[model samples]
Target: MSAPGGNWGFRTGVNDFWGEDHGRKTIGKTILVTGGTGFIGGAALRALADSEPGTNIRVLSRQPLPESLRTGEVLHVHGDLTDPSSLRGVCEGVSTVLHLASHVGRDPELCDVVNRHGTTALLADARRHGVSRVAYMSTTAVYGHGVHRGLTETGVNPLPVSPASRSRLFAEQAVRGFGGIVLRPHLVYGVGDVWFIPTLLRLLNRVPSWIQDGAARVSVVCVDMLGEVLSGLTRIPWRGGETYHVSHPRSTSFRSIVRTVCSTLRLDLPSRSLPVAEHREISRGMMPELTDHQHELLASDHWYDSSRIWRKVRQCPGPGFSSRFARAADWYRDLLPIG
Candidate 1:
């Protein structure tokens, strides 16, 4: 969300995806969205199109978009974050920058280059172009994995573990230093998500079990709704550089997610259960990809206080995981059908 003077037109829909627009401060404003080809980015593209009519949208990408991803009236500009020179002109005429582009990989250098240095370069370009506001999509993983519950945005220190999270922590600082807003979502799941669910299935594929019933409470949000939120943030009259936890207030348990996945996707996973010690040993021996940090994420609580953001938009949290996940079930079914 933008700072106090920027009036963001936002309200929750009573019977729709995300409607009830009170006032759209972004009308006729050219909004630039980066990483518009990735999982959550895809959803944001559509959501922005639906939510804010008459707003000029510029999607920055290194490669041309495929035919299927082409949204109406979205001007695709050829740009790469890694190449700082390429970003020189992308921010021209861009009133607001929704910075969702990030690097998520094991390569520390790539992460730093894209997430930290790239963001700094982007912010510099935006400043030169007189871009008024910027919003960043950071991850709660910056706090690392532990039993975090009901944590506020300003209360905790970020002890990042992975190269990705560490780099993003620095990215957040750059965004904050520029008087921009930051949103930290724990687990985002829904259509086009090739990471969260598939990763879980990978762990289960190697060892079909849970660590002590897998009751780790995690905050989850559907991509569709998240897209809508990001669009609003571009125009919302928010507190400057104020961080918010963007998630449903209700925490969904890991065991419940597994059960839902099995039932919805008809997967015969979790056929057996294991204790924490055995699970770690087997994962270490067979599936080394399942790092200890990943295991800790699945075996503990990570929920944040997201009421502030919901209130900012004058909306209540949408449906819980069961109902919300059902909205995108068909897409997932087609993508990961395994009856």
Candidate 2:
């Protein structure tokens, strides 16, 4: 049973968790954040620190703490998810847990070991330590191979096409069994991102041919926004099986997004066209990292309905599509490293 206002207790369907005061009520709570050094995890750390200054934050990292994280009252713990013994004392006295670490490589075997088995280990340890609430970060790619318009949470059982997604789904099953909240978000982009924007920038220079004429409508969310929603989730109480989709209400078409980003970067858009099979062949030769499933993601219309999460947080609407892309273009070209 879900308690009301306890460590894991949160009111359902209430958007006032973080009011005009910016979630000041969240102060003084202890939260252990895994993957705190990664792109989305780092954003969540900053958002939590900024919103609830008094909140005690613990970050789990396998490597030494980065210089930037050492400035504040953040506690950095050295550990690896694959090594359960390394996780000692990390969950002690923590009221909440955010599991964001995952193996994002192309190997299905490794993906299961890290994403599935690793999560299983962490959840077991957290439960043992009396952690009240846990939030698992998931991907929209879980719903694989579908032309979705406004897919709702629990809308479709994930038909994961890739090993990464399959493993994530497996992890989701574990989280659900453990009574933790699951957040499934689509392509997240922001300042620290090295893949999404940089890859697109590189693609603009080569590959004369494109897929589906770049007309797929894709759903994407800003990293900071996703962080805020996640922060809110930690405080709000919910039933053990609650799941939510995270994304902006508006959907941006692939063609328009690419054209706008290219224009901002002062790069030329791919004007040439090719059949789907031929386009896949060229991408495979050039960008071997993109798997067959990824190619389909680029070519198909995939988006989600995020009204369930949106109603729970009072966030200022972001800028328009063109302006958002323009800002990201500048950041990708200058601030973010591309190679």
Candidate 3:
């Protein structure tokens, strides 16, 4: 997870994050950023701004942006995704669009309204405005839960079960139909995370046990790298809609995830390891948010081969999870405040 001020490796300029030079393609361009104040959006917004200091940026949000994002360089556009009328002229004079806003909850109608219908309206507006390029943020959960290991972008068929995932899949389909790019990242963690870290902490707080000691290996990315990857996408010469899995080259064991979280927050580790069957019997329905399928997913392999994104952005995935986790210990401790 990447906090706003964490080390995102943008010292020299935005081009430095990409490692190689592409004439700084984003320079002086009019780019619009949706969901610019959310967790991932905030990180990506910061990186995009730092990449090209003088570029014109339009941030769309239903609520007011934080003081941190209120720099004079950015043009805040007040709009709501749920209301298509508000997005009528939002994309005008914009060269690039970064779609990051979505409804992530159990409400199916809300998800359909915000994630699916909202995106369709935005894309329609983008096409009418003659926007040059568009990029969308998606999740690997669109593939559903399984023993997925080292799967390519198109290796597995998308079988989303959750309301949020299903609506996002529809949004992805709309983006591809408009010939825009889609980026999927699995288990993104760092400073601004409110899902992965908080949910895991809740699970551990109630029950300090895992099925088979969390041996399942999963692919993950830090928020800083993820933001840079999203900002770096505008520079790629992509056409006709392409999907890429965005994560580190390496994978981490679930055991290591629990170990690191516990160590970082000074929490107790699982004292007993139970078989999957027994664990299900005891853990099921304990948390209304987590289901039996999610429990199984937590214990299975979810490694996705994301080397393509690393190559696309030309940015190093940096060190492994253990090292990266240490760097964000302070942020996690301050947020989670559990032991």
Which candidate's lDDT is highest?
3
lDDT per residue for candidate 1 within 78-170, as digits (tens), equals 777787777776776666788888998889998988998889888987776666478899999999867898899876899999999999999
TM-score, one value per model: 0.89, 0.86, 0.90
Over 4 Å off, model 3 = 1-27, 337-339
For every candidate in turn, the CA RMSD to the true structure comes to: 6.5, 6.0, 6.1
Deviation (Å) of 182 in candidate 3: 0.5
lDDT of 2 by residue, 236-338 (tens): 6666767888887788887877887767767667878777788888888887777677777677788888877877665654763666665456567794333
Q: Weakest 10 consecutive residues, lDDT, candidate 1? A: 1-10
TM-score head-to-head 1 vs 3, winner:
3
**Residue 164 lDDT, candidate 1, scale 0-100:** 93
lDDT of each: 0.77, 0.73, 0.78
Clashing pairs for model 3 are 1-189, 1-190, 1-191, 2-190, 2-191
Residue pairs with backbone overlap in model 1: 8-235, 8-236, 8-237, 9-23
Q: Which lDDT value does model 1 have at 52?
A: 75
Looking at candidate 2, the ten consecutive residues that score lowest on lDDT are 1-10
Candidate 3 per-residue lDDT over residues 191-255, each given as its tens digit: 88877777778777766787687988988888888889888876665564889999888989989
Compared with the true structure, model 3 gives a TM-score of 0.90
